[model samples]
Target chain A: MPKIVAFACEHSAYEAATAALERKTGTAVSGENPRFPIVEVEILKVPCTGRVEVIDILKALEGGAGIVVLLGCFEEACHYLTGNVRAKKRVGYVRRIIQDIGLEENRVQFFSLAPDMDARFSGIIEELSKQVVNMGPGPVTRIRDQTTKEQAQAAQAR
Target chain B: MIVAEQKPVAEILRMIEGYRKILVVGCGTCVTVCMAGGEKEAGILASLIRMAWAREGRLGPLIDVSETTVERQCEWEFLQEISEKVAASDAVLSMGCGAGVQAMARMFEGKVILPALNTKFIGMPERQGLWTELCAGCGDCVLDRTGGICPIARCSKSLLNGPCGGSQNGKCEVSKDIDCAWQLIFDRMKSLGRLEALGAMLPPKDWSKNRDGGPRKVVREDMLL
Candidate 1:
């Protein structure tokens, strides 16, 4: 199964994700609360989506995260105006970079959310998990192992 | 400054096909200003190469990629500063102008140097993010006679006595977007009260000083320390 990394904004997606967790077990989404875990879903909370950069996404993919998703606030709803827009642009750039490097573009995605939209946040995670399962493991790890094997075979041939 | 554009990634990959360990070097001067090749671009290219090679399922060999940037790639001092890096790597992928690439090749002797950018021309920015050619380095400048406008670079034909009957509505016949060089000269000369300059017949250009002179060089013994 593919590992998925989701960079969620504190003001929006983080809250929504916490709310979704609260729906499963009667608990408040707060610093004192221990959240519920969705299978293969790793949440990285950032102050804002704007804080997330192209390098961060690229590094995640290189580090064996099969899928990288950015969860930000909707439209003009960003507390820091244009934060989501900036994140969206960066996501597009990273998507293009990965695509150029022979990775599937769909491996990187951006979704906008509201603070209270628990259902939508859960739905996005479920959808991404399904997509990751379909995509299988990323190519980086496979390539590393393949190269080691080839080198061994070449040495034996000599 | 010289303006350049990066070559296609496929061509770059092809150029370094046999090389396993590579140094992807960037220039901080002309190529960077032109957005063709810079430190950031160097990192991107290196990452792309590694990613692409990895995706190929390690068909050939283990590709080891490293990156660095010099203040100017055309200068011997700057090139020498990264001599150790160059010596460590099997080949160099230079993210610099053609001249810079040649300079490194000359300094490094037998080291394989590959150019990542195609040097376009000597130009200046027309606006933010928009660059326009302003000179052709023809070795003979006539801007003094043409009211600071370059006929050699602007005119499609490079005619000494121009307008050539191809100018329409003050625009060059080649493209409506381009202003006729002669028309611009005439207007500027008239405005500057130097209309008589246009009447002066220009002599045949001396091509000896241009590229026709094989591998041009300048030597100033007096300036030698």
Candidate 2:
């Protein structure tokens, strides 16, 4: 199972995803299962992408997330004027830092969208999920496994 | 206020790599107003380091992470207030100015103290998010003679005379971004009907009184209550 963490803006990305899911369920007749693969993602909701701090993004990666995505408002459309703009710069900063630490910068990303763009939201999620799957697990997960193994060995010795 | 910019995250992480428990300190004065090494920045940096350590599975070396913002890190009382916090941690990461870092090191004595900001200069905000250097604290202020502007601090050449002849369109020839300090001085003197003061050749500035004399100090015998 692939693990991806996405910080979804309450005003745009989160709303769009909710709306898309509702429409999918609404169109399905009784007892007909939705064909879309339910991707395993931990969605963190933020009032605005601007509120998503640089540390929050890094924490997601540290918490065994193979991929981290920031979904916010489209350019020139943020309700908070420069919310999306600020988020973009912070994401860029985090991306450069992670790259410097020997991690793939592509593991972290940002996408802008509108509240009504449900199809686009789902498309982005699917594309990111596929990309993460191809990239395999992140360094954080490997480190966790190594630490756990060492701890277990030490316990056995004790 | 003194302006500062955070050292890159990678460099900061590398600095505190070996420490198990760290206390992140912040200055609430100059750093706060400049949007640099303040309480908010301290929390952000602490969180980033913890996350990075956890990611690398170096959890053993980053057990306890604490943060505190003092009223002024450069002051002894403020450092004294967080003495217990500093003692509890293996190291201290100070989000204060250069002076604050040394103050902490002086007070703490033996702890590993790291600086999180590169203290830029004594400056004021030119706009909402822009800072411009305005003072050199030459120990001899000449603002009265130069229309409240310090040519020692602003002029590219620090010329005691008028414009260096390189000034063009009121901008410094060195960079279009910087205003010609001498031009500003001339304009101000002209408006104040004090251009005649410009002709009074000022004597050479005393070098021993400035930074060239080494670490400056102030002893207030009257304030010793």
Candidate 3:
């Protein structure tokens, strides 16, 4: 199972992402089934991507997600004038931070799309999913396994 | 406002390696304006250090990082307010300018004082998002002529007489991106019709006033210890 998380803003990006999922598969567009492969892809709808704190992104990675992608409204098209720009800057900051902490920088990415651009939106998901497949599970999962093994050995010694 | 940049996360983490209880102090005046040693920055640094320590699998000592913001660290009174918190902590991380850090060190003589940011220079805010260093604190001001471009402030060599022939097309020969300060002065003076002032030639700057013998000190008779 590919564990992916999509952080979408309340504006155009969320709507466009939903529409793209419906368009990708021939499923009926409904609230129940948004229709994207890996239905477990947790979709976090934020008020604005700019409001998504860097700590939130780090905590999500710590919680075990192979890939985390932030989707924002197109440049200059955001409901807030420079909200998307701020989001981009924060994402850039987070990318550097993740790399410094020993995580692959490519695991985190940002995509911009207008409310009606379904093709571009779908392409982004497909590309991100392919990258996740190549990278495999995140480091948190491996660290957990190692800790579990160490605990078991210590328990046996006792 | 005094500008400073946060020390790298790894370096900060290494500095506080053994300390379990830490106190993070921030100066709200100069450092706050620079977005370096402010309340927000201090909180972020403390959080990052905490996380890094947790990853080391040591279940580290009782780590207590608290924040206290002071108006100006140059005064001993503002620093004295945090005497209780300073006494309780195993180590103190100061996120103020160099002056503030030194003041903290002086106030708490035997306590370990670590600087969390590097002090850069005296500069003015260029715009909302930009700050450019404008003064080297050479203990002199010669902005009367040459339209406010201090040959001492902006020039690489701090030349006051004239361009050193290393300036080409208004750019310094040492580095391409830098605009020769003398060239800028020349243009500004020409525009103001004050080019005649350039012929006067400034004498060598007096060095006594700036870091001459040792660390600079100022005394006020009315505000004595």
How far residue A148's Cα lies from its native spot in candidate 2, in Å, is 3.0
Across B101-210, the per-residue lDDT of candidate 3 in tens digits comes to 89999999889999989999888777865776788776767788658887776888888787898999999888998889999999999999998988886677787877
Residue-level error in angstroms, candidate 3, position A117: 6.5
Model 2 lDDT at residue B153 = 85
lDDT of every predicted structure (CA atoms):
0.82, 0.82, 0.75
lDDT of 1 by residue, B46-116 (tens): 77777677777643445588789999999999999999999988999999898889999999998999998
- Rank candidates by DockQ, best first: 1, 2, 3
User: Any runs in candidate 2 off by more than 4 Å, and if so which?
Assistant: A25-39, A134-142, A152-158, B61-65, B191-193
Q: What are the models' TM-scores?
A: 0.79, 0.86, 0.77
List ranges where model 3 is wrong by over 4 Å. Answer: A1-6, A16-44, A53-68, A116-158, B59-61, B64-69, B127-129, B220-225
lDDT of 2 by residue, A112-154 (tens): 9788877787777778777877776666676667788998999
lDDT of 2 at A82: 95
Error of 1 at B99 (Å): 1.3
Reference interface contacts recovered per candidate? 0.35, 0.38, 0.00
DockQ, candidate 3, vs. native dimer: 0.19
Order of quality (TM-score): 2, 1, 3
